[model samples]
Target: MLQLSCLCGQVRIALKQRPDFVNECNCTLCSKSGAHWSYFHPSDVEIEGETSQYSRQDKDDPAASVHFCPDCGSTTHFTLTESAISRFGNVQSGVNMLLADESDLAGVELRYPDGRAWFGETDFGYVREPRIIGQKDTQP
Candidate 1:
């Protein structure tokens, strides 16, 4: 299973299979927080730990939503819309798989996007090398 945890070891999550989408977004809030997201179906996820969800609402779009951990103020994941894709991405939380290690995370890759002009500069460094699989850091 795929597993993730938080910095403070408070929250955790597990996925039985690989997620369908994983990429970096440069929207206003995402750029400011600098988060790399891995999207998956909520049914494919098994979660544990305490995540105090901070939600926001807007009349213009009426459905944009994101979630951040209250403990570390870290952007964990978000829901694209409440109707479906309710679980868009799964951030690595503090709950780690008991026996999972390197071999299991081999195929997970990260992507950088050039979507918005206000994202500042998108630099993910040399990731094709062997030393680091992705950003080595999940932040933008």
Candidate 2:
């Protein structure tokens, strides 16, 4: 299990298990918020605290709602809307890795998804690859 909290510690989240991978999407909202996504079943997460929500909708995809700390302005997590829930039945929970305490993230894989290209309806100009963004340093 992993414990995650916002910058001001007003919002806390308890993940049932370490995520196998995290996604770094290049979507407009994701780029601005700088979130690394880790998906959960909603039932696997325990959240405590109040958060402000911002919902975004697109024609092609289901509506997504982002939750942030009202006090610290930290992006905590996101969820699929009811319509999306009925369609996909999957929820994505993002954690601001910058706010997380020192933990072993060496095993987690980092993926870069070209949301901008795909969602923007532009030509495929980006590379689809899974890069290692976190690893242990042996020099210490």
Candidate 3:
């Protein structure tokens, strides 16, 4: 199992298996929160302890309820809101992979999604090609 926890160790998440890929989005919310999202059905993850949740006030109907550790202010995960579940069904929840040690995620693929241009009605464009977490340094 892959175990992740917030800075204060208050919120914990256990994943039964490694994620195939994780999205590193550039949207305002994701960028500001510093979350690299790995998605899975809620049933696949085990969450413990408590967290405070926030939904975007700007959107008339926010799609996700973002959770964080209240004590340390660490963005932990996000679950689809009731309205979103009604619209999209119980699809998946996003766990903040940033909470995990990079070494623990060394082999996972990281995808850069162009969330900045996504308007919520269409598919997301890629900002760049995906990269393996611990691949040889390709940058000079």
Best by TM-score: 3
Q: What is candidate 3's lDDT per residue for 1-140, written digit by digit as tens?
A: 99999999999999998888999999999998889999999899999999999999989999999999999999999999999999989899999999999999998999999999999799999988888998875744
lDDT of 1 by residue, 31-118 (tens): 6655656656566667666666534442344343555556866555555555433454433331222223545555555444444543
The C-alpha RMSD in Å for every predicted model, in order, reads 7.5, 4.2, 1.2
Clashing pairs in 2: none
lDDT value, candidate 1, whole model: 0.50
lDDT of 2 by residue, 18-137 (tens): 777777778888888868777777888888999998886555554678889999999988878777778766655556554455455566776777777684466534446575545643
Better of 1 and 2 by lDDT: 2
Q: Higher TM-score: candidate 2 or 3? A: 3
Which regions of candidate 2 fall more than 4 Å away from where they truly are? 57-62, 90-98, 120-128, 136-140
Candidate 3 worst ten-residue window by lDDT: 131-140
Report backbone clashes per prediction.
Answer: 7, 0, 0
Clashing pairs in 1: 4-93, 5-93, 5-94, 6-93, 6-94, 11-94, 12-95
Q: For candidate 2, give the lDDT.
A: 0.74
Candidate 1 segments whose C-alpha is farther than 4 A from its true place: 55-59, 62-64, 80-104, 117-140
Candidate lDDT values, in order: 0.50, 0.74, 0.94
